[model samples]
Target: MSTLPTGYRTVVVPPERIEELRTVDQLAFAVAPDPEADQLLPFPVPHDRLMAVESPDGTYAAVHGSYDLVMPVPGGQVACAGLTWVGVRPDERRRGLLRAMITTHLERSLERGEPVSALFAAEAPIYGRFGYGSAADQVRLTVPRGAALRPVAGSERLTVRLERVDPGRHAELVEDLYVRAGAGRPGWVPRATPALRAYTVGDPPGRRAGCEPLLLATVLDGQDVRGVALFARKASWGEDGADAVVKVREASALDPASTHRLWSFLLDLDLTTTVETPPLAVDDPLLHLLVDPRPTRRRLTDNLWVRLLDVPTALAARRYAGPADVVLEVTDVLLPANAGRWRLVVDADGAADLSRTDVDADVALDVRELGALYLGGRSAAAMGSAGLARGDRAALDRLTTAFASSLAPVCPFMF
Candidate 1:
C-alpha cells in the first residue's frame, strides 16, 4: 500500500460538493467550464465512486473516479472498474497523492468484486509503475475522399441515409448498434448507464470545434439498420477547390456488406476532401476492405491499459485460445497477494483453472506483462524477447498460441 503524505487524508466526495470536485478537475486540467455542455451531457461519474485527497485544511488536493463496467474478455465478460477522471492539483504533484488514490481504488474495486481495472491513460507513462499494461492498440485513419473499397457481396443492395443527429431519437439506436457491432470482441465496454449513454450522443455547441453539428448516417437493408456512423464536417476552402474534412466520431457495422457500404458513403461525401476516423480495432472490417492502405495516413495509439487486481480470478474470467498446462511464477509489487507461482490448466474448450501451486515454474513474468497478455492481444513471445518475461522457448511459443486473440482487442471510446 502507498503511504499518504503527512497531514493529508482521503474522503468520498459528497453529492453537494460536486461543484468543488469540478473546480479541482478544471484547475488540474486547465479547462473552463461550459455550463451548456454539462446541462446537455450529464457527468457520468457516480457520486459513490468519487473520491478525493483532502489537505490538512480540508481543501481537495486530488480526485479520481471509477465506473462499474462489465468489460468483455476472451469468450466472456468480467466485472471491471473503469478508472477515469484522475487529476492532481498542480501544487500537489510529487507528493504521492496519486499513488495513495490508486491504492484506495484497487482495494475498493476488489471489495466490489471487480478483479480487473482498465483505463485510458492521459499520459502513457503514468500507470505502468502501478501494474497497468497497455493491452490494446487502436488505429485512426485519414483517407482521401473518393478512396475506393474492395467490393463486398451485398454492399450494393444496402441503402444509405444521412441526416442531422437527434440525440433524443438516435441515442438508444446508436448504443444498441454499438453493442451488436462489438459483440465477441474483448475490451468492448458498453454504455451501461443513462448518463454514459447521454454522453455518447450529446453534441453541445460548445463542444464543437468549428465543425458542423453532429450528423448521423445509417446503412439500411430494407427496414433493418445494419450500420451507423456519427460524424461532423469542418468546412475549408483552398485555392484549388472545396477542402472540407469529415471527422467520423464512431462507425460500426453488423456485416461486411454494411462495412463496405458505410465507408463508401463516408469516403465519398460531396464537398469533403478527406475523411478521418475515430480509433478503430486493429482488425476492424474497414481495414480489410480498403483496397490499398499505404496511402491512408494511419496513427496507431495505445487504447486500453489493464491491471489484474486479483490475478487468479482475472485469469479464470477469460478463456484461452487453445489448451494449456503450465506453471507461471508471477510477481506483483502493488498487490502482494498475486505474487506467487500458479498452475493454469485449460481444457479443449479454452476454459481455464488457476490455482496456487508448489510446482516448478515453466514461465516467469511480472504482473504487468500478465495483464498485457490477459486480453490475448499481446504476444507472450514478444514479452519474452524483450526480457519482460522469462520462460522456456517452447513454453513461450505455446503460450503465445494459446493467448492469441482471433479478433484484436479494442476499446472503441475513451472513458
Candidate 2:
C-alpha cells in the first residue's frame, strides 16, 4: 500500500485506491464508468486525484480533484481538475461531504494556479450552492436518408478527398490543424490524443466489431489538412437499406472557405444515402449554409457541464451578447454559501450585476445549471420545466435565447 500525500488522511492504500474516495459518490448518484478512470488508454493528462471528505470515525466520505489546470490562464492553456464523481456513501447521507469537497476543490484549483474549474453537473439543482451558473447549450442534430447539401449554386470550385491513413499519423495531422479551427468557440477543449487519432482511422467499415466510425476528411489546398468529419453509418430498420445515418464525431474547418467546402462535400456524398450530426451550436454556419433548416431536427442535451469555483471571477469573465436585466434566485443543495437570492442584472451599457441583493430577481435556478444555461445548452424555460427556474416566462425566454446566440455548446473531447 502507498502512503498518503501531505495533508491527506492516513490510510493503508494503493495508488489505485482513488476510487474508494468516491464512496460518497456511490451513495449519491448513478453508477457509471469513473471519469478519473485512467485517462482513456493512451495519453494520460496531468492530474491529481485524491480524497477530501472524511467522517469523524475515520471513514472516507468523499473525493475531490485538484489538477494543474489553468496554470497558464492568460494563454488559454491550463490544467484543470473539474470536480467529478462526487457523492457520499449511502450510510453517510445528509452530511456535508459535498460541501467539503467543493470548498476544497475550489481552493486547490486556485492554489494550483487554475483560474477556472469546470464540470457537467449530474443534477440541475445541485451546484448553485457553489456559485456557478449555466454557461452553454448543445444541439443534437440528425440528417435524414438521402439528406443532401449544396452551396449557393456556383460556389467556389468544390473538391473533396477521403482516405484511411494510419490512425497515429492522421490524428496528429488533425490536431496540428485543430487549433486554427477552434477560435471563437466556447466550451471547446483542444481534443488531440493518440487514442482519438487511432480511433480516427483504425477499424474499417466491415463487421469485425470495431468498424464503428466512418471518417471523411478533406484538405482544401489538396495538401495541408483543413477540414475533417467523423461519422458512423448504420442501417435503420426500414423497408429500404438505403436509409442509413452518419453520426458525425467532430467537424472543423480552418476557415470559412474550408468550412463551406468540407460540409458541402460530406452532405453531397451519394454513397452515404443519409447523414446525422448531433447537437450543434445555433451559431454554427453550417445551418445557414444549408438550403433549408426545416429538414434538420434539433435535439437538446446537457453538455459542457460547469461548476463555478470562483463566483466573481467566472461571472465577470464570460462575454455577454445582449443587454438585459435579470435577477435570479439561486438554489444549491450542495453548497450553502451559494444558496441565496441574488440579482444578475445585465444592462444595455454592457454592465452586469453579480452582487448580492435584498430584492427579487427576474429568474431563478441552481448555479451549475445556470452555468450550462448561460451557454444556452438549457433554455430558461427548459430550466423552469425542470423546476430549477421561474420568472417572467416570455422575458426570460427572450433573454436566454438572445444570450445563447446560434452557437450550440459542444465538447467532443472527454476528460
Candidate 3:
C-alpha cells in the first residue's frame, strides 16, 4: 500500500483475486459495525464484475461492488447502480477513503449511464452524508405447518420450474421481472444481473439449501408470464422447529388470478407447518386474504438501506408523497459531520427545504431507518409508537400503508 493517496489504482476484481476481496470485506466491515455488506458478499467475489478502489501504495482499505442498475423515469431512463461490499480499515478512517471510493465509483456509474445507486446498509447512520436514505423495507418471517396452504380443489395452468436460467440469459428475465414489479412500488431496484438472479433462484445447502425456492410462473391462455412466485420450498428460515416457511425470493406480475394462485400454491405445501414472510406491504391484499392475521408473522424492517453517494441527486430523485412540513435529522457514520438535523417541507407537489434549515424538524431518523421506512420497514405509525415521529400517527400510518408494497424483498443471491 502506498503511504499517500498518490499512485492509487482502481480495478475490477479478477477471477483469481475475488477471494482477496472477500477477505477485505471480512476484515474491514467486521470491526466497523455493519454486516449488511458482509452478508452480501458471502460467496466468491465476481472480480470480473467487482469494482474496487484499491491503494497501490499498500493502503489497507478497499471497496467492492457487484452490479449496476437502470432507473426508469416518466420521460427517459437513467442508470441505477448497486454497491455490495464497502469497507475501510480502522487505520484508514478519517482519511476520506470511503467517500473518495464511492465518489469515483458513482461518477463512473453515471458515466456508464447509471442514474441511481442502492445498497443495503449495515449501519443506518453511515450513508446519509452522501445523500442516501431509507428507500425500502426488508422482512424476516416464520410460518406453521398447520396453516399450510392447499390449492382450492382444482386449479390449472400454473407451472413451477426449479430449473436454472442460463447465466447468459437470466439477466434479461430477472431485469424484466424487477422492472415490471418495481413500477408499482417505492424503494425498489430495477436491475437484476446474472449473479443476483441466480442467488434468487439457486438455494445452496445449509439453511439456504433447505429453502427450496420454487420458480413459479402463471400462464393464462397461450403463454403469458403474468405472475411469478420467488419462494423457497423449505419449511422455514430459523433453526427452531417453532417455524415453518417458504422464503419468498422476489415476484413480478399483475394479474389478480395469478397472484391468488401463487400465494395459495405456496400455502399448501406438504409436511410444512407454517409460513413466515419478510416485510410485506401493510396494504397487500395477501394480508387481507389470510384467514387469520395472528398466524401471519409481521415485522417492519428497512428493505433497501440507502447511503447517499451524491446528496442533491439522491434526495431529489425520489418522489415524496407525504404531508408537507416534515424536516429530518439525517445521520451517517461514514460522514459523521453530515450527522445533523434538517427540514423537509413540501410546496405544491414537489419538495422544498431540502437544503439545510433552522426550522423545526418533524421526523428525526437515521438513514437505515429511512431505508426501512422508505420501503416499508418502519411505518410512520410504528415510528410514532417508538417516538421517532411526532406527526399524526394514524394519518402517516394510513398513507404509508396505502403506499406500502405487496412485493417481498428477496435477494437470495449476492455475487
Candidate 4:
C-alpha cells in the first residue's frame, strides 16, 4: 500500500469487527439501524475484501469494501471489483483517509486479477481525481397517465398479472427475465449473489416511504413470463382530483412486444395520474416506443464510474465496433505501470490485441478517459472536444467508430 498520513494506518477488516464496520457506516451516512430491514435484506459485502483505516489509538476512522462482480461489456463481460459501502467518520474528514483507502483498494483489486473497478459514486466530484471517469449515463422520466405508445407487433398477444412481491417466490424469475432483457448491452450487470437477489425484491414495511407494499406485474405469453415490473403507488388527493403517482423501482422485458405490453399496463394504472420510471439507458426500447417523448420530464445523471487498473486486459475484454490499429499514450497517476504508450490492434471480428509499444502515439489521454470508453458507451471525439483527450481528427474519428456501441450502456441496478 502507498504511504498513508502520519498517525494513520490501514488494515483488512476481520469478521469480529462486523458491528464496528456497520457502526462507522451508520454514522457516516447518518442512518439508523432498522430491525425490519435487517431481517429482510442481507448485507452482501464480503468480509475478506473489507478494509479500514485506524487512528493511532486503534479506533476505526474509515472503512470500505469491494464486491466480486462480472460487469457486462459490449459482446462480453469482465471481472470487476465493485467498490462499495465506503464511509469515513465525520471527524476524519479531509485527512486523506479516503484517498489512502482507495489506493489500497486499487492495489488489492489488481492483485486479485480484476482488471477494472466500478462504483456508484455517492458524491459525483469525489472520484474524478482518483482516475474514475463517468462512463455511462442513466435517465429517469415522469410520464402522464395514458401516454400512447407506437404499436409493436404481437404486443396484444401478451397478458398481464399483478401480485404482491414475494422475494422467495419471485427472485429467480426476476433475475432470469432481467438477464434476458439486458443481453448484448454493455454495463448491464446482473445480481450474481443470492443476497443481492433477495435485496432486489426486499420490501420491509418500515421502508415503504408512505407507499403501499411493493407489487410485481408480469407480462406473460401463455405459460412463459416475458417481462416484470416492481412498483408501488402513493395515494394523494389534490384539488384537481386523485393525483396518485406510480413509482417504478425497476422494469425489465425480454422482447420488443413485451416491452410495449409492460409499459402499457404501467402507464394506465387506475388512480395514478403520473408514472415515474427508474433510471434507464438512453436507447431503452420504451424511449423508441413512446409516441412523443418531449413532454416527459426527463432527468439525467452519471450512472457508473470506471477505473482501469489493468488497461490492456480491460480494453481487450470488450468487443469494438470496427477494426482499427491505433497507438494510445495512457497516463495513470496511481498505477504507473499503466502509464506510457501502447498499441491497440483490432481485427474484422472486433477482437483486440493490445501491447506496449515504442511507436509514436496516435492518441494521447489519461487512463480515466480510457476507462470511460472501455464499455463503448463514451466517444473519443467527445473526449477530444472536451480537451480530455488529444489527437488528430482522423485518429479521434477512428477511435470513436471503433468503440461505438449499437446500444447504450446502463447499470439497471445500483450497487
Query: All models: lDDT?
Result: 0.93, 0.57, 0.53, 0.92
Candidates, ranked, TM-score: 1, 4, 2, 3
Task: Give a tens-digit lDDT track for model 1, residues 162-193.
Answer: 99998889999999999999999999999999
Q: How high a TM-score does candidate 3 get? A: 0.62
Clashing pairs in 1: none
Q: Answer with 1 or 3, whichever has the higher lDDT.
A: 1
Clashes of 3: 51
- Sorting all predicted structures by lDDT, with the top scorer first, yields 1, 4, 2, 3
Point out where model 1 deviates above 4 Å. none
Clashes of each: 0, 45, 51, 0
**For each candidate, what TM-score against the reference?**
0.99, 0.65, 0.62, 0.98
Please give, for residues 127-166, the per-residue lDDT of candidate 3 as tens digits.
Answer: 6556565654444455444453333322356554444334
True-structure RMSD, every candidate: 0.9, 6.9, 7.5, 1.2
Of candidate 1, the 10-residue stretch with the lowest lDDT total is 34-43
Model 2 agreement with the true structure over 319-373: per-residue lDDT tens digits: 4566665666777554455567665656664445577777877776666666555
What TM-score number comes out for model 2? 0.65
**Of candidates 4 and 1, the better by TM-score:** 1
lDDT of 3: 0.53
